[model samples]
Target chain A: MKTEKGQPILNIRNLNIWYGDKGILSSLSFEVQEKQVTAFIGPANCGKSTLVRCFNRLNDFTPNFKFTGEILFKGSSLYAEQDATTVRKQIGMVFRRPTLFRGSIHENVAYAARISNVSRTSELNAIVEKNLRRTGLWNEVEGILDETPVQLSTGQQQLLCVARALAAEPEVLIFDEPCGELDPIETVKIETLMRELANDCTLIFATNKRRQAARVSDVAGFLYGGELIEFGATEKIFTNPQDSRTEQYVTGRMG
Target chain B: MNSLMSRPNPKQKFALQSIALLTLGVVSLLVWNVLKKTYLSDVQVSSVARVSDPVPNLLGDIYFFLSISFLGVLLGITCAFYLEEWLPETNWVRCLIEGQVSILSGVPSLLYGLLVVTVFLPYSGAFQRTQGFPPAGDLNTASLQVSSFQGDTTLFYIAVLTFVLLVVPRVIKATQEALRSVPIPMRESAYALGANRWQVLTKHVVPLSLPRVIAGACRAMSCALAVSALFIGIYISGYTIQPGRMSGRFALFLGAALVLSIFSSFLSQRYPLASTRHT
Candidate 1:
């Protein structure tokens, strides 16, 4: 497996998060290697989603949501006196269920770039085309760019969402259960796309599916009960896990 | 009773059916009464007429209704945007404002008119003083004299203010409902793409909620037109309609209601969720 070795893009130190006194993430300390797929594998409600939402400041919208942590993005603290919008611009996210805006397929792909102040029609078209091509959706949607995405299949919509996310040219992309709603074929496509995306962008793939985490990630962190039980190279974590909990989880004995 | 297809208790079922029928009957009678007054009644032409033709007067009334409703809807959209988007839903200020809107929505139109007469007209007296016009000679009599240029503008603005007070709460309620109907995930999607609050609203939420808002505005406008006519009949009868021309005034109100209802229904049918198709 190819790995991009460099300084870690994100460093989380003694992070604690809560939503209205219900603790979500507890003392998470880890580093995400730059330009590599880092998977956070956990069961449902294990704070994987919340942790990824933190990277983009998406959790700020949650009422009574608070976090005490130092998360460094390229050595700068993410929680410092900086605009959340600027942080989000650097860290894009793809959700579990596909969400498309109320516009044409072309418009959906161009939304991010447009919001970034790219207004020229040709420029938006190029960005949309490039991202769509990157996600392997260009051929399928080329003829019907003006059509609403409502008619697209679930898999197509998910691909369109990935394409939309890529349009902004984000540095780090987080996929929070992106394949939760896909069939096997669509799942394979998404997994392959994640591999291709890892070539250029740092990825944080959070999933309940352990096998998927093994398949896609260079580094894997096993989160159980809102705690990072183990973290290391994917191969070592699966074959020779340091923690008993990690052993039970990877071997399917426990969740 | 043991059978799955067994009928309900006969006495209870009969009572429910009778109540439903009675409600239907009452609603039908009310609708019929209004329709008769609107179409069948003779339009009495007054001798000392400012505008003899009821058509022009009807058109003028419609213009007034549209102006007031448009302003109300615009302000309501702004308030809804602030409440739903800018402010956190759990914020005390948002809750307080929402509660106030609910209370205002329930308040009767007469009370708004009373507010204009007691509070607003007296305040207009301040503006009159600043303009070097003699103080409104008599508050009550000056308010009634809507024909004079100065009094007419003041009264028009006061009427607008009153109708806006009446219409705004309804618009705010409708707009808020429209904004709420937009899925949270859609907004999160936009935010995830690095779009700020204003961009997310303009590009996503507003477009999604527009059809519903326009539909709501149509309903509010029709209600405003009909209710304002009734309000005028009660408060300033000498302004637009003579004492004996109640039937003609009723016709104008009913006409506006009918046209606006059709328009509202047309809007609802034409663009219902067309822009908001989710896969």
Candidate 2:
């Protein structure tokens, strides 16, 4: 694989994360290039989510959760001196389950802009509409922007979450098993969206399903027992895995 | 055989039933006496008459003040919630704030009144000192009148300040608990979307928890109203009423207490009672 010389978008070095004396990930490292899709595929409880959370320092909320690592974004250590608010604005995340605010669907999308000092009504509406349309939720939600998101179907709410994430215009987008809760059709829609999103921003996704990882990811990393067992192109990892574990996982012999 | 068996247990059953009935009768009698003496005596009627004409206007004024106090409490809780979210790194500071809130909630209202008087009244210079008065002149008399008005305004200031402190913690705890009940995942998702802590709280947590927060505020408001009535009663009964005067403040105090109690119960109905099955 050719390594880009200019500053990699995100760089993780010997990142070790722990949750209350329990080591979740040890000496794990990776770099995400600009405008590329990097997928993390692992069995349950392998610390994929933990790794993603470290990007925005969300793990700080957990009591006694400590990490010894260097995570650099745009040549700045995200963990050292960078403000969490700024880091979060640059790297958005979409969770496994659909989380909608209690207000109208429009508010959910416009929430980031509203909070970030975008108070002009016309600009706010444009941002909300553009993001929602990009996520393919505008057609369904346009007539009823004022309606509570709780009224939307599960699929619509998930799509709306994507729209909300995009509203912030984050440079590095992370999806944590984003389609874990979706049906087959919805999952396909999200997978397609991820491909489309990769054209503009670096996309990193964590999924337990190997097939989903193979389908959406350009560069895939197989995590096993808190280690990056294999990392390469998606086709190579799926069809011609160097690691036995990766082959077993992709062939359904083992997770 | 069945008839014989039924008679055999009848005596014990009868004794137990008789005991239960006797207990119920005694309890009801005691309750009735207490209710009559405390809530339904002839003195209560006189108390109502003493302030009947002025009660509505006075209560309207009190309600306006109470609403403002409620708004203050709401704002305080919102501030506290944001503080908790923003100062995650400063756990000790959060603990200190929470501890202060609990202490405020537990402190007696009368003590708060005393604290307010000590801290605000003299330091604010609302009370003018007549130390530089001319010797026995007409000017001294005019200066004394000016000082008296200042003292009156200061006292009113102290009273409102005391009331606000007394009510703030109840509102804070209620709002905090409501916010705490929100699922962490919901908040995390908001943060993941690049929403800042304030944005997540106001946009996601606040709206989701508003129903519960509003319910809590209603409860806290009722408690504050009841406590305010007691504080006013004690203050007026001790200081405001003159021995030979009509004791209008005392009458007003009692009337306010009754109205506040009734209003508390009415507000309570807005939230479902435990006796209601659906809730």
Candidate 3:
């Protein structure tokens, strides 16, 4: 299931996920292109968040969570007893709610790098500065590197989270409703940042906001009732969606 | 307009307040009785000597308090860590171990004392007979003569061990609660950053939960101190009375125990909130 652009970075085959008896994603199959923004857009409870969580294996912590079928990363089985830590190191995630550790702003951003054994003070400092600069947080927080994140607004905390994820230099980054709690201006800042970030890192953005998906993603997946109804180039998915539900969803008529 | 749900239930509230006030009154009465008994007694010549001779009893209390608190906290935290981190939630063995700790905490303190005495007395007797390590004089020194440990070293060790058993479960329960209180998302974010279980526990969980753990340890310390102080005070005062000694020494023991209990309680209540706010 290679994508048309080039080799597929991730390939899902008839994936199904469940927590207890309740099904979340059913028979979801898609190919994610390399170094591009792939957006999964749908209404609430459509399993878009669950699907992205699967990529980094974050759902393993959820009690009773079980999934069948295969997810291939760089053409290899991602769940054939692969080490979750190694998988997550290469595939990072920014959650909907900003979750910063209890520490200084510098420590928050340097966390991933530190865990990856980047120990030198100079090295950690450079990584922190580089990531803060990358996420456009350097100017705001550079002077207050010693300050805790409780001082930051929700939007700023989210941007710091992005910087934290970026410090790892992951090959892929999953944004699960990254702008869900942001103001319009903050949302715009992150959306623009996502487009620029696509130049270097493969991104998977999950959002219920259709226009944001159309505006930001290179490839779009329209999921409904745990099924991926449509997936293609963002322009085609928006302009001429093959499924009536996707058409209703994209035109703001139905969820 | 106030909804019915928002309205307070006066009947239930009255009942609760009455119960609380009644309990407080009862406790106050008991404390007053103990104080009156200690302060209004005849000032015997031996009473003055007893008052002056608090060094041994004070040392004994200190030894018991420190040993019980240290052992309880160390063992409690270790058990809690094993339960929370090393074992999966699905493991029945973890559940069984936790159940035993819970049961131990609920057992009456008297049962613990009786159990220790019953088990150790025979064991010490057998050891003395078999090895002659402790001479018969040491074993037979259980007279009402108030020496360092109210007479018997074996009895003191047994009491310390018994109190440790009581305190350990409480400490373990507290540590578990503290560990559980570390926000799940915090651990999630750390794990998302590629931290293994050990790294996440050390770097995020332990640091975040430490204040609460300390609070729990303080609570256990207060319990151990209160029980030990009161039991020792009653036992020693009872024996001193038979010997025509002063009961004023009981007041001093009570005062020391009250101070320690108040300090520990204040710490248990204030520490977690303060640390969390500071962070």
Candidate 4:
């Protein structure tokens, strides 16, 4: 695995998160390098999603959500006097289930642009086309850019979500089991797209599937009971894990 | 399949037949009542008064405006969800906002009108005074005539304000649910891409939740419309229905209602998740 030696794009320190007084993650810490895929592998109910949400402040929406942590983006404390909108603009996200706006395929892709005041008709069209093609959705949706997203298949919708995320020109991309709902073929397509996206943007993906992390990640972190059980290169974590929990999780004995 | 089909008991068949006949009779009686009220009733009284048409029409306009305003309130609530994302540390602020929304939502529209009459109308008067207008000439003073504008028609403004407050919680609750439905992975992905918080919400969260937000707005609007209609019915009941003047007002009101209902129906059909979907 080729690890970039420089200032990390994301620095998380002693992050602890809770929902209604029930701790989900405790004292978690890690660094995500720029332009590389960092996959988080864990079992269900682990703090993988909670840890990822800290980076963008997405967990604040929960009524009783609370956290004690420090998240730094490019060396600036993300939680200090900074706006979430500015942070969000710099990072984009894709979900397991594709969420498409109730509009044309073009409109869904162009949504970020519209909000950011990118209203130039020609520029907007160019962006929609470029990102759609990048995510491998252009060919299927190109012929019907004006058609409603509800008309597309599940795979296409997920691809469209990728295109939508890319439209914002973010420097980091996060995926929460982006292929959980996809079949094998669709999963392969998404994984390929993730690799392509990683060349230009940092990728932080959280998944319960160890095989998936092994397939796409350069650096992998195993989370268990809200702790970072192990962190190393994908090969090392899966084949020669230092911790017993990590071994059990990756070998399918536990998790 | 043939073995499973046991012959029906005579008593059971008779009971089913009687129940079916009773249901049919009830439905036919209700339908007859509707027909009689709509078409067969005495036309002379209806023609001379023409009360129902104008009242419902004018009330409809009030309903339409109230509904649109309710939509705006819902949109505001959706925007509020993203705003809350920025204030993660301020649990008190979040609680306060929620409390305000709840309190306002629980207050009845009529009570809202009363409050508005007490607070906003006086404030508007004060504002007018500060702008160099003579203190609204005292109704008791013989020198000034109290025009309709100066009268208690402030009820309209109060009704709208109250309706907005009433509908906001419903909108917010619906919007919050929709935003919550979006998986956290999607949000994390946006953050990982180096997108800022606002960018993630505006770009990803808002769009994904919009259909649900709109649906909430539709529901809020319908409720506001119904309340406004009821208010108008109660308030306007005693107004002397002058043929010429009342007819115009009534026509305008009905026209507004028709347009709003049509628009609401269209929105619902076009965006079924947020509105009603035509099947």
Candidate 5:
């Protein structure tokens, strides 16, 4: 894992995960620097999604998933001390396909804040507007927060998911292949949004596309077959590869 | 979607549709049989002693069956919600509760009535002095003694207890199904937003499914009213069935059905026709 910056916010130490009889990720370790965008790029079934899920304890929701490891958030064991519910408050997630509740867009974005007891109608509206604006969605959706998220375009839906996550005021924001299903334009918009979001919170993303990794993240980790093969500054890893497999992958030779 | 989904080779489907159409008349007939002759006739109430202007008969209900059944309904709904909210997530607890509900639903109302007669009635305040089915000579003494002594309150409440047992199973089953209809992601979203399991269930899941829960409860209410009315008349009211009381029983049945329809309309008004797309 790259460590050009100090003050790592999330540390995954020797995490091994299994789903029933099948081992998915083994002895994997990584560090996410505070207020920096870290992206894991890999091929299909390369365990990138599983890794991102580990960060926010989303992996626990998967049936039959068994894991043994310590994920430290801010120098304390995430699972040992903080329950998944509490840890998740500080770590938010955006799915690949936008998963929005069936409600007005305003309700969808303000869900987390409401659950966290961010009382006062004025404050909730302020949070909704600020997060939407930060995600570049406020202008597009101005005065139409009453509309359902289903009415938004695919691009706008993805950004709405970001806004919803942001309203939680999480210290770590995770995207599981945020643009995996989006068009090129939507992909670029999400990438730009991730870059902008890094200034406020630690960002970790998983993508199957190598170019998206190079475009969005400052630190890049290459995961293959449930193992992190090589990780470093994005430019150095792409320009001068450390591992043959990384070269093979970046050159479009083989996954 | 396409005129009964016309296909080049439609013989098998056509045959199935023909069979379905043939059964429609028979199914409607069965439904009509269950619902017809619901109003009490003179012959049906012939044994009942005729009485007129007896406190308006309160729509033919001689006993406080409606009030008692209402109390039973309140208790059933409260217990159902409590079980759902407080029960642990263990497999056996769920299985045990759901299994008992399934069994209880199949139980005959008479068996529940007999339960009230043989088991509950003995311990009721009405029988506080001479407990355990009084001697044959004391049978008349028992009813007269109890109702006269307690102002029919003991008999009324014991009958209500039987009604609650009948309702809890149906209400619990329906409420559980209603709660289950909420998607898993809805729960997961709440969890991700920092809600404990109980909070997620009560605040998010319960509110989303309230209409269905109430609808289920309304169904239980109708059944409880019908069954419990007949139950008390047979077991608790002694052999002297009054014509006014019998007419009141049928009226109560009709009122239950009417309430069900009203609840159905209220449900439609409160919530949009549900679409899977929302999930």
Candidate 6:
């Protein structure tokens, strides 16, 4: 199995999660390499999104949520001591749907920038423009920064969410099915943006589409029934999976 | 756990509908019965606008009570909005303050009046008797002389304070609900973007919740206005409606209620109800 040369940005070990005594994730272990796109693909109820949410403590609000795990980010325990807000700054998220705040398109992109003490308008505008450009939304949304997010198409809204995440300057970007609610054209746009953004930030996305996982990821982790069934380079997993189940799943024999 | 059934059975739905209709019927019947008991005389259009007996006093009553009610409603909305924004549901302080306010909602209006008489009336004189205003308050004579403005600003103070206390819980609850209606996903998105609680609330939650907050304020103001005349009149008229018995004067009171209600309803519709889900 090939791995990135440097230490992984996220290291998880013996991660056990439960919802009211029913185990959701059982002693799962994985490492998220720096500045590479990692994809977790699985059938429904595989705890894919839950694992991504844990990276930023977004799952902290779930009721009857209990987890015992060591998720280390840059050698520090993510859940043990570091403040959730600060953690979120380093590990930004783009949700399944574009959950934009009730504000203008410009404000949406500049939100994370504002919170991290990017006060000056010149700097904020520059950041918004850069991120919007990076997400391929600059031309479509230019000169309309003040327009509310409600007016944007679903595809544009999703792209704006990507721009918003980029504004935080996150080291790790987690996308929870980023194109789940979007169309094919929007999906292609996001996939292209993800390939470009992987050069700068560690991208970990959870998706139900194995084809998408095969398309973009450098490394693919297949999780099934809360277990990491296989983890390796995406091409290797597709071409010559180490396990029979992985081969069968990749060959469309089963979900 | 098993998921809840989506639709209620026909029998249950029928029962619920019947219960709702019955409650509404009882309320209308009760109001009709009260109106019957009052024996309100005919409205004389000529005297309604003129400086006739009972006209001046009721008009003064409307102005005084409405002014204070407006202030109290505004203040209530501000506090509630701030409390919701600054102190979220996760904050222990919010839980405590909201709990107390919810308890206060259950307190009767009569008890509020009693509290005002005993505890508040002493300090009720916020505005002093201004010069050039007579002490007698010309209610029996003109439509509105400056006389009614003087002699015991205390009554106005008591009425306002009591009205505020009576309706504050509803305002707070309404504001909180409005804030809630802005979608938890929006707040979560804001928080996920690294905004502190304060930043997320002020920038996102409050703006989204503005229309609902205004609606809540209007509802509170209307409640305060409708009840103000009753409570304030009890003291002014020496426990009798004799002062308001004049035919056209009751018309003036009803007209004030009608106009204010219409105004507030108009104000509320200015902003269409905003919801993140709708978009």
Choose the strongest candidate by DockQ: 6
Model 4 lDDT per residue over B41-110, tens place: 5321211222233444456455546555646564657556754455453344544554445444554665
Q: Of the native A-B interface contacts, what share survives in model 4?
A: 0.38
Q: What TM-score does chain B get in every candidate?
A: 0.55, 0.51, 0.57, 0.48, 0.53, 0.52
For model 3 the TM-score comes to 0.76
Q: Which residue runs of candidate 4 sit more than 4 Å off their true CA positions?
A: A1-7, B1-279
Instruction: Choose 4 or 6, whichever is better by DockQ.
Output: 6
Which candidate would rank higher by lDDT, 3 or 4?
3
> Which candidate number maximizes lDDT?
1
Better of 1 and 5 by lDDT: 1
Model 5 lDDT tens row, A164-244: 888888888888888877998888899888888887788998988888899999899988898888888899878898999
Q: In candidate 6, which residue pairs get closer than 3 Å at backbone N, Cα or C atoms, i.e. clash?
A: B51-B143
The window of 10 residues in a row where model 6 chain B has the poorest summed lDDT is B237-246
lDDT of 5: 0.70
Off by over 4 Å in 6: A1-6, A19-23, A119-121, A143-151, A239-255, B1-149, B236-279
| lDDT of the candidates, in the order given | 0.76, 0.69, 0.76, 0.66, 0.70, 0.72
Candidate 3: segments with Cα more than 4 A from true spot? A1-5, B1-52, B117-152, B229-279
User: At residue B230, what lDDT does model 4 achieve?
Assistant: 47
Which window of ten consecutive residues has the lowest lDDT sum in model 3 chain A? A1-10
For candidate 2 chain A, the 10 contiguous residues with the lowest summed lDDT are: A1-10
Error of 4 at B252 (Å): 44
lDDT of 6 at B268: 23
Model 6: per-residue Cα lDDT at residue B215: 92
For model 6, what is the alpha-carbon lDDT of residue A243?
Answer: 84
lDDT of 2 by residue, A1-255 (tens): 133422378888998887667888889777877888899998899989988888877786675578897998888899787988888888988888988776788788988887788999899899989998898888888999988988887878889999998898888888999988889999889999999988788888999998888889888898889888888788999999998988899999997
Off by over 4 Å in 2: A1-8, A60-63, A102-104, A111-130, A145-147, A240-248, A253-255, B1-79, B86-90, B96-165, B182-186, B205-211, B227-229, B236-279
Query: Candidate 6 on A70-160: residue-level lDDT in tens?
Result: 9999889998879989998889999998887766899889988877778999998999999999999999899899999888899999999
Segments in model 1 whose C-alpha atoms lie over 4 Å from true places: A1-6, B1-56, B113-155, B233-279
Give residue B175's lDDT in candidate 1 (0 to 100). Answer: 87
List, residue by residue over B27-59, the lDDT tens digit for candidate 3: 455355444543356421122222334566567
Instruction: Report the number of the highest-TM-score candidate.
Output: 3
lDDT of 6 at A60: 78
Write out the backbone clash pairs for model 3. B47-B246
